[model samples]
Target: MTDTPTTLVTATGDSAGKTAITVALARLAADQDSSVGYMKPKGTRLQSNVGKTLDQDPMLAREVLGLDAEMHQMEPVVYSPTFVEGAIRGTEDSEALRNRIREEYDDIAADHDQVFVEGGGSWTTGGVVDLTDVDVAELLNANVVLVAEYGSPNDLDDVLAAADAFGDRLAGVVFNKVSDDAFESLDQDGIPFLESKGVTVFGALPYEKELAGVTVGELADELGAELLTDASTDAFVERFLVGAMGGDEALRYFRRARDAAVITGGDRADVQTAALD
Candidate 1:
């Protein structure tokens, strides 16, 4: 905690607009003409190019925050697999490792007025990874905002599970990528169902292209995404699809890329096939 007394923002429950929330919060806070700062406390799976491992996501905040801050400060750890699970699984005494992590957290917490810390992935999605988002939030002393991806009525259980995860520090959760019909159902059944569990619904954002779309200017502004093809800054984009579809017919889709910006998520087999080609 710095002398400024910053409020830490941690969102973990399915990637669920975590990055978007980070950007939007910064955008909204900046719009208010306030001096707020951003940080991702931790990171995973950094990309290396030309012997340089780059922290892409946090770079977006640096550009938006208008701060000359380096990526190292925004994202403290950039390595394979998230650090939480990594620490929990090892025989290396969780208490000692936890202390080290907290030390790293306090070091950055000492910097800004209000630091927005984005949590990694979901809290409950566990496999061999034992430590979850709850651990991260608890260690960091941050409040939790769970974003429910279950847009339909049948997903009430999902919402309940998230509330249960947040426990005492549960601030307010939002339902994202909601459909029109689903939103209707959510208004009646879903919202009441969530309310019954004592969780407040903040705001539900529809699945919009703008969230994913990157105008060349926005792309350039975003230090995370690189523009393969050069274009004017004034150019705007419609939608960005990660993982280009494989097959000749699918490639033909790109022929109509006038207003579309294809953003393929690599490591996806279909994307690797189509995007690599």
Candidate 2:
């Protein structure tokens, strides 16, 4: 900690991959000889292992960023049972939670070179974290990195709203899962759209399935279904293309794929049949 401040990585919209981007950025800093500190300050909907809720992502960050402190200290609050319980009753106090989050953030931030603080969910989804990216950014008094999804009609609005909410604390935006077609959609309207709203498009990413992490078997577990093939266990895909192509197109790409997992919800007979085929 240099008595300055740390960087807070945030996202404006859903499925923006804030965690992945934050981890990647921290890894970048570590690569450049900076001892990076990472945190996902708030999170809900944890992955469960029997009675224990696994804090896998943060643990991974601790390993990758090479932290020496207690893992739980990095993330002081787990917005699982408590957050959901309050949210269900519609009695969750956003500002109060913000204060607690900030206090915890300040503590960890005091010792690290660059602490990367990530948010819980998108602007709309919140259980207990009391933070959208904007709220967290404001409370932390740190720079923001808004994760944006390309090809969405409301991307501009969401991104701008987050920046405006954070004001001077807002840094820039990184666009996630940006496909070639998505970029084409934004081609003419892209620069004007961002400039019109006073925002910067930091980086546009190609869709990577590994980031999603909801593998076939994992989806099977979540959906209460059995894996049809052993491939579901080991098939970690980097991306998924659904109806983007025709007969030859599907085979053309899938034929070259090795250990690609097929992830879809339960009772989607159409997808189940397709995967089986």
Candidate 3:
């Protein structure tokens, strides 16, 4: 194992694909025969499995990448409503939490040539108890890769803010879910503009519905519903169009979705059949 080489993957907002990017990087590094480790230092989404409550992403890392680490170590801090209240009241121990994260990270790093650290949410999501992405990055001494979604000029402000926040530790920014129409201008003008502002552009990936999606079967599992019709669990749903209109209008809206899932009341046979048709 090398000397705890690590990169912290963070994003601008929700659905920015931070976890997916971390997984891809870890898989690529492992393919190149690098001993790779993965960790999500803090998680907001909790899942109760086999009598243990653990965060989702770190469990994903353990299962998908075959990483050998305890789930608690992979996800040291879980944010519950009570935890947030404690943080707000200044009743939580920030130093102890930081020490726990550092000790877990050091253990993971000791066994791997490189480690990929996944941040919780946006840059400021965990600031209540000093567990923000920047805080964790500074604690771990890891470089930062900021993932951003392209929608408007305001996104540029977020990227610049991240660059200013990380400063020299900022490795680069990867634009996610960019529209095809915007791709040309972003690739041609947007990249150069960011570079001129002293922020390196790794690459802008065109928006693919599949990359930012969850399968219908997965949704059913979460909602505890049984599937009556056979649907491909691997299919990625890029959008969700509610069937609220008449058949003609509904069909028109349905056509607009690429790899989308339609949701309607079970009693609405018209909507269901229209979506099927």
Root-mean-square deviation (CA) per prediction = 6.8, 7.9, 5.7
Deviation of model 2 at 77, angstroms? 1.7
Q: Estimate each model's TM-score.
A: 0.66, 0.69, 0.78
lDDT of 3 by residue, 120-200 (tens): 878777888878899988999999999998876657888888889888889999999899888877787778899999899
Q: Best by lDDT, which number?
A: 3
TM-score of 3: 0.78
- The sequence of per-residue lDDT tens digits that candidate 2 reaches over residues 40-130 is 7665437752233545667777787778766566665566765567667877766776666666666677776778887766754553445
lDDT of 2 at 215: 61
Residue 232 CA displacement from its true place in model 3, Å: 14
**Backbone clashes, each candidate:** 4, 1, 0
Candidate 3: segments with Cα more than 4 A from true spot:
48-52, 214-236, 239-277
Candidate 1 backbone collisions, by pair: 242-263, 242-264, 243-264, 243-265
Query: Regarding TM-score, does 1 or 3 come out ahead?
Result: 3
Q: Residue by residue across 1-277, what tens digits does model 1's lDDT show?
A: 3443333444435456777777777677667766666666545435752223555667766776686656666665443444444546663455554555566556665654555666655555322333356676676666777767655566777667767866887787777877766777877777777777788888777776556456678767776756576656666676565445564644666655556555655555654454435
Score residue 212 of candidate 1 by CA lDDT: 47
